[model samples]
Target chain A: MVEILYFAWVRERIGLPREQVETNAATVADLVEELRAREERYAAAFADLSALRVALDQDLADFDASLDGVREVAFFPPMTGG
Target chain B: MDIRVQSAPFDFGAEAGAFATGHDNAGAVVTFAGIVRDDTGSLQRMVIEHYPGMTERALEKIAREATGRWDLKDCLIIHRHGDLAVGEMIMMVATAARHRKAAFEAAEYLMDFLKSRAPFWKKEITGSGTGWVASKDEDEAALGRWSKE
Candidate 1:
């Protein structure tokens, strides 16, 4: 089980702050593809990757990174940190 | 280390003093406070919204990274949420180190990362209407320089 989280406008667009999913996603990109196929809301929330950023295991990371054994994935806007 | 995300206002002097305690060898303490400014001229108040779990984790990561990069004895970060009046304290960062340079640089680095890399969002209450505060490209550029340097 992998915990997926969202923040900022991404959360507002998806209408959820977090969810747990079972997946065979090899990488973050694969998980994103799976999410985009889940529902219109997910697709709309992830329509533009350029406007989004990803963190794997609570650290800033690229989407191409593998998600094997990863327990958590979080998505948010290009962080306005404070 | 202490990290707080709350609606209450913070006292900078008191917070800094607390972090500097129990470290007799620490010779310098640097503090940075971000105030709710009506810099946009049209903004009357600001509402800061954040994801509860992820926001706290993100802040902790930033603080940890700062600790890794600098030789620091202690650190404190406080961020306010919900509605804020102009000139109210939005965030405060305090760092204690053996030298002035490390304390000052680490404090600045932490603020830079906090401003551009955190998950918190702001909505400006203006005469026009309440709208999300747009993140500036300049803030990203500022943070990018740190990585390159």
Candidate 2:
């Protein structure tokens, strides 16, 4: 099972902060596609991929990156941290 | 080494001094603090929200990346959450290095990555209503410049 985490507006939109899901997806994009198909809330949260950012196991990464052996995935808005 | 994400206010001077302690090889310590401004114009207050687990991890990753990129002795990052008033300290970053160049560069690098990579969101609460602050494309572009160098 892979742990999926959400943050900020992404969490607000998805209505949850974290979840553990079993998936057969091999890449971040595939996982996102599966998530988008789950429910309207998921679709709405991930509607515009351009406005979002993804990280795998705490490291910044792209959507197309492979998720093999990845234990965690986090979705968040373009950061406004500093 | 100190990382705090709290609703309470912080003492910038105290934090900076603490990070600079016992570092004889460090010739310079650079610190940067971000303060909430009344410049939002219509907003009376701003609410800063973040994902607890993911936020901390993201910050640590950024800190680690900065440390790897620069020759630094230590670094500290503190960010406050919840409602904040104008002029209150929002965040602070401190970096210590053997020279001013690494210290300054690392501090700036930390801020830049924080601005574009950390998962914190801000909302403006005005007399009229509340609205999510739009992420600026310029901020992303600014961060992009760093990757090229």
Candidate 3:
């Protein structure tokens, strides 16, 4: 099981903040595809992959990054800090 | 080095004075503060969201990088998350070094990294509506200036 978190509009679109999903996906992209297939809300939240950024275990990572042994995944739009 | 991520507001003058006094041996101290801007005059409040664990880690990494790249005597970063009224301070960064050039450059470097690299998102709530603040391309471009140096 991997914990998934969504922030900003992604969270609003998905209607929640975090969840635990049981998956055997090879990478972040594969996991995204799995979530997108589960519901329309997920599809809408992830419709534009280009607008999103991914993090694995609290570190910024690419979508193609391997999820092996990873425990947490976060999906959000580009940061607008400072 | 000091990094703080909190929902409570901070006193910038006090913090700046404390930072400067704490690093009295340093020849220069530079500080920058960002306030919630209501450019349209319709903005009611700004909401900042952050990934808790990652936010602190990312900030620490940026501060560490700045210290490593410059001859810094001390560095401080304080960022607030949660709802904030217009004109309220959103964040502040301070850097101290042996020279004015290093202090100024390090502070700028910290701002550049914090603007995009940190895991914080801003939502502006105005009289008309609430929307996520889009990341500007110019801000991304600003980062390029540091890479070659």
Candidate 4:
């Protein structure tokens, strides 16, 4: 199971901050597709791929990147820090 | 180098004074602090949320990159997460180097990276409601200038 996390408005829309999902996905994009298929809330949260940023195991990563051995994935809007 | 990510308020004067004092070998020290602004006049507060583990890691990475790019003697970054009232400090960056140009440029570089790279989000709470602060196109464009060098 991989721990999936969401932040900011994505969290609000998804109705939770994090979850553990059992998946056989090969890449981050595949995982996102799996989650999007599970429910409407996930679909809404991930509707626009370009508006979101992904981090794998706490490091920024591309959606097409492989998720082999990855333990965590975070999805959120572009950061507005500093 | 030092980095702090916390929800508590920090004393800017004391921190800046202490940072400058120990860097006597360095000829210049520059510091920049960002304060919450309430241009609309109705803003009650701004709530900041961040990915805890990743936030620290991202900050360290940015700081390391800044130090690597310049001849910095030392650097410090302090960012606050949580609800903040108008005029409250959101974050600060300090850089020390042998000359003013390096210090100033390093500080600016840190700010530019911190704005977009850090995994923190800000939500503006006003009388009407709350909304996430949208990322500006210009802010993303600002980061492009650093890559050429």
The lDDT leader among the candidates is 3
Using Cα atoms with residue i matched to residue i, what is each candidate's TM-score against the true structure? 0.83, 0.84, 0.98, 0.98
Task: Arrange candidates, best lDDT first.
Answer: 3, 4, 2, 1
Residue pairs in candidate 1 whose N, alpha carbon or C atoms collide under 3 angstroms:
A81-B117, A81-B118
Per-prediction backbone clash count: 2, 0, 0, 0
How far off is residue B10 in model 3, in Å?
0.5
- Candidate 2 — what's its lDDT? 0.86
Residue pairs in collision within model 3: none
Q: On residues A15-39, what C-alpha lDDT tens digit does candidate 1 reach at each position?
A: 9888999999999999999999999
What DockQ class does candidate 1 belong to?
medium
Alpha carbon deviation, residue B138, candidate 2 (Å): 2.8
lDDT per residue, candidate 3, A10-69, as tens digits?
999999999999999999999999999999999999999999999999999999999999
Task: Give the C-alpha miss distance for residue A56 in model 4, angstroms.
Answer: 0.4
TM-score of chain A of each: 0.96, 0.97, 0.98, 0.97
What are the per-residue Cα lDDT tens digits for candidate 4 across B2-111? 99999999999999999999776799999999999999899999999999999999999999988888879999999999989999999999999999999999999999
Ranking by TM-score: 4, 3, 2, 1
Instruction: Give the Cα error of residue B144 in candidate 1, in Å.
Output: 3.9
lDDT tens digits by residue: candidate 2, B43-93: 688899876766798788888888888878888999998999877899999
Model 3 root-mean-square deviation: 0.9
The whole-model lDDT of each prediction reads 0.84, 0.86, 0.96, 0.95
User: Among all windows of ten consecutive residues in candidate 2 chain B, which has the lowest summed lDDT?
Assistant: B140-149
Expressed as tens digits, the lDDT of each residue in B19-94 for candidate 1 is 7777897899888888878866887998887767666887888888877778788888999889898888888998
